[model samples]
Target: VTVCCVAADPPAEAWVKGGPVDPNLLGATTRSFLAKVLTSLMDRFEQDDDKDTVAAAGEALAQLAMLLGGPGVHSVTQRLIDTCLQLLQQEHICQSSDDELDGEEDHDGALWEAVSELLM
Candidate 1:
């Protein structure tokens, strides 16, 4: 899954190289491919317990969300938000104090921050 995330970055960077995206640049086949890859990443994110795996999947989904748009795209955005919220909920269970989070907590927090940045 980490490999998938690593693999996603370059193309994502290329796709968003210009300031604003023109959706027509992504044709039907490209959109379909992205949808498949995004779905796979989301699934991996939900199933993985390893922090690195989860973080990678989260990052990849965030990048993909930056490209996916138009009429049916709200479903994708909603699903991504739901997934991030679910991750936050799970992280919340581990919180015991306001200022005593450890390394794992930091990782989860950072991942949440990244997701938040993407959503906004």
Candidate 2:
């Protein structure tokens, strides 16, 4: 989690312009770091059964996408949407009358929330 947070918010000096830049336009070092961070977060988001952890990864991915504002944003957005849709198709997300979810259901809800944040 710490690694993801740090990766999402790279050091100011890591950027070619002292701030966020398009991943494709980044230097080799920054590009490598970005790839590793994206892979790790995607892996966690896809494989983790823990709702909180998955949500965190999703949020990190969103943050990274925002940081790298370019054509990469479209790819990341598509991947997130596809993953969320796959999860929805594989499981039946249900909510109780009290607007609460449990166990696996909570995972889906949290993921949707993260995706919503990403889209916004």
RMSD, one per candidate, in order: 6.9, 6.7
**Error in Å for residue 17 of model 1:** 18
User: What are the Cα lDDT values of the candidates?
Assistant: 0.55, 0.58
| Predicted candidate 2 versus true structure: per-residue lDDT over 1-120, tens digit per residue | 434544665544443323444454544554556666777787776667556777788788777665554423433556667666655565412211234445656666776787676665
| Pairs that clash in candidate 1 | none
Residue-by-residue lDDT tens digits, candidate 1, 4-115: 4334542333443324455444445555566567677767666665555667777766655554433213336666667677666765222323554358667767667656
Over 4 Å off, model 2? 1-23, 71-78, 88-109
Candidate 1, position 27, lDDT: 49
Q: Where is the poorest 10-residue window by lDDT in model 2?
A: 91-100
